[model samples]
Target: MSEATANDFASLDAGQLAALRRRAILSCAIGNFFELFDFTIYGYFAVAITRAFYPSGSMYGTYAAFGAAFLMRPVGAIVLGAYGDRMGRRAALVITIGLMAGATGAVGLIPTYRAIGYWAPILLVLCRLLQGFSTGGEWGGAAAFLVEYAPPGKRGLTGSWQQFSTQIGAVTGSVSAALLASSLSEAAFYAWGWRIPFLCGFLLGPIGYYLRNKVAETPAFERAVETRTVEHAPLRVAMREYGTRMIQAFGLSIIGCIANFIFVVYLVSYAINTMHLPSSAAFSCAVASGLVVVVLTPFVGALTDRVGRRPLILACALLNLVFDYPLFLLAIRGNTFKSLLIALICNAVFQALYTGTIPSILAEMFPTRVRYTALSVSYGFAVVLFGGFAPLISTWLVDVTGNPFAPAFYVMTGGALSAIAIISMKEYRDAPLE
Candidate 1:
């Protein structure tokens, strides 16, 4: 037989292919869940954490410190992402999981301001940097791992699990924090109740590690190794060959990041600071929104496989631009549980359209040899520019303008940018998984 004919015959049958794809998705999703769980625990417990480390006289200082921690994320992504492309996805996954777990657990044990003075905030920043580093490398490796193993026609469906897992983690963190906070007095909650969620990371880590280790290397990576197709300098190759794609990825990411910050992070702060809602009520609404996102994400992923990334992304962006101001007004004016829940659900469902398919779309833009590095570097930079700084900028904008609608304008601008980016990209639905 000809070499091409032999290669064609080596492909798995339908049943075997289904089984392999399931295993790959589950393995990577489990690890991704814990990584997000650890990272998001901070946001969920931010009020308690800020109270523990920063004085009540300066809420701005407390948030500023949190923003500083977020800034470390891009650096972590670049260093760890390059390592994943150079070495292998499996090794990178293992290291990231370990670092995330260890750093999270250490946060639980760190001394508070009363105990350690200025060192408390310093140590908090150090732990956040470690968490940032682990998360930076985690998404690209995990998403690439799943997509590289997926069937060509269904990579979007398989890769969507990564995005779905993030919302799952958010829900998990929220519920855990709510339960813990409910069980304690306000003094106790501020004193030590916040640490329990971070401690839970230790238990989550081993389960993720076991699942990730059980999955075999992806067929794409195996083939690349066998044929010596691995790039000697994946970063250099990505910058030279795929620079435009990187810019597109960044532009596309703006809406997702802004949506998350506005709906998830700043929403909580707004509820507490502006609307004068109870912390529990605000967090409960967030948990409900997360559940909505989790339910909608997989379906959107399947839809993207059928309709293509451009239409879904563009639709979401345009809808966001139209609806953002109204939604924020509804949320800020009503100040009731029902109104909050309605706004949260709408935001989560719309955001899922972009978030669900992004992993597959970004991964498809590059070949297997440099896919992890390319996606990670682009995503990290976007997060730093759009996601990490979003809450701080929006807060400052609102303060400066003395208008709650200032944040609405910010959201509209991000959505507009994303719409432009999505329309500019080539239709990647028919692209090969490699």
Candidate 2:
């Protein structure tokens, strides 16, 4: 393949290239799907995990442990992101899936605090950190893979698959949690039932590794290597040369990441614990919102190719700023299953518009040589700073201010920041990748 050269890719007929793109998409999508599934199941099962790991039974300890994972993300972004830029995207993706899945499986097997004392929470936090580290690399690597493989006019559609897989993973995780929570007795669920999803996620790791290994290296990365343009030190180059671009990606990521965690991941918990809604109903509603993202994101992604990335993403950011507070009020005051579902779905629609285009935007911001490291670092820091601790911070906001609508303020802050980024960004929808 080293001798094959960029001309080899150029020589491929349309049918051959199309087939190759599909394989690339499937291979890249699988790892992200599994990664998100495993990560999300932990969030969905936080209540059970809190009961098992925290002796005091206060969710603060569990939330801290959850937030601890985010702290490792930027480190992973710098480390694994550089690895991907240097070694290869495929190599880094394979390693991330193994580490992520292995840690997830370990979480399933950990003994509760009653059985293991303080060691239980220690073990749980360790596993979460490992998951976070792997996830930091997985998303950027996968996005780079897909967008690099994408044909000129179809980058948005191809890149959307990254977020599409993510939504599917969340859907599956929500469904798994909903099923287990609904079917098991409360005592049983708190005991062994919650481990089932984690273990199942573990079982799929090897399969993802195998599929990724079978796929070819992306044409863009291969060309960079062939041209001797691959950066030996991508992280340094990115920091020195692309600081402004990195900031743009970071700012753009803020609202989407926060909204995803707050509305999609945390809302279930908020519904159950704060609003006192039924667990089954909350998870089911999450599934509905996730489905909306899964179904709508691709179409919205395709739309961006026609309408321009700036318009849709800017609209999403502005709308999120305008509507999140009222929606939170609707859910908080009404406090019904239907009301919560409606609010979540509305958030999901806005979320889809941004997420669908972000993969392409991030990928387009930098050249193939330093793309992985730069994109990963920017996105990872944004998530760690704004999104990763969303649940904990939102909880604290409510606790301190005595307002259940407090989380909306957090989401609105992201929207405002991201709107500035979107407004400042150059429209890259029709631009070629560097």
Candidate 3:
């Protein structure tokens, strides 16, 4: 806050710093793009995956296999999160993408259940574990890198690129799935065509790794390194020092994660199943929703820079609370264009108001030393708890209750929890990150 300190911070706002900032966002966003493209594509292809692996007529079994990966996320957070805190964000970013890409390509290589017996699902689970573990570290490091490297006035805009690229990944996955399913014969798709997307994921990993490798360590991290301020045991210090912030992070994260998984990933199944919509229609709807988010997220991020993160976040939660049930009802009203438009509207709201702010809000929570660790743990644990199994849970809720709109209640409940956390936490927009 002092004049000398302000001057020091301003020194990094030079042209070279601007270049670093752009490259940093570009690299981090690409990494996130690949991670999410792989992530969402798995969901998009879950039916084929289950038919190939589970093959028992239980889709939940497939979703459960999908959920199994998430259980490893918290563990990945602790291990790789610490690596990011200590070794540096760029190094951790490269490692996470390498693991993600390998597992993704491995998913394509596994033999079908009929071909390999139970080994098929076993291989699937193993690949999921690797993907989950690596994913645990990717977002935390990317968010830390972007927020730390960002110039003061542009943190929201730069950080928004993280989720902006996430929607790009989602859009790519949905569009790819739609095109593949539409183009391929049913027998061919179930047999081997589903593997193409996973195999394609191999190309992105190397690109993401190359980009992250080219970037410098964030200035905040470099300063910590120079001052010997890096914590040797980052997770321990994070838990001891920022327990409340971590708890708040979980609270804040729950609804956003639910909204994302539900609207983006789960909606594919929800439309195809509960509403009995055509697969192509459902896929097209998902693609439209993703495009909406991709278009709108950056504007929302810029708005947060002006109005601060708290208001938009709270507004997002409140809208979900007030409109979630109605939104679900609208989505199920008919298998028409109107139905898809309703879903797209909900996706737009979730993306612009909530998802856009996640990187900035989360990065601003803890100091630089333990920031990545805290974010990884809190966000990872929250996703494992709710986001990972969201589709499974939504499907189960519908199966058990026989209410087609049962998933709405889950998102609505998340809204209430998020409201409480937002009320409890400090509004830190434009505040010093460390």
The candidate scoring highest on TM-score is: 2
- Ordered from best to worst TM-score, the candidate numbers read 2, 3, 1
Q: TM-score for every candidate vs. truth?
A: 0.94, 0.98, 0.95
Encode model 3's per-residue lDDT on 268-327: one tens digit a residue: 776766566766778888888888788888888888899998889888888888888887
Indicate whether candidate 1 or candidate 2 has the larger lDDT.
2
Candidate 3, number of clashes: 0
Best by lDDT: 2
In candidate 1, which residue ranges exceed 4 Å CA deviation?
1-14
Scored by Cα lDDT, where does model 2 land? 0.90
Candidates sorted by lDDT, descending order?
2, 3, 1
Q: How much is 258 displaced in model 1, in angstroms?
A: 1.2
- Could you tell me which 10 consecutive residues in candidate 2 have the lowest summed lDDT? 1-10
* Residue pairs in clash, model 1: none
Lowest lDDT 10-residue stretch of candidate 3: 1-10
Candidate 2's C-alpha runs over 4 A off are none
What are the RMSD figures for all models against the true structure? Answer: 2.9, 1.1, 3.1
Cα shift from native, residue 375, model 2 (Å)? 0.6
Clashes of each: 0, 0, 0
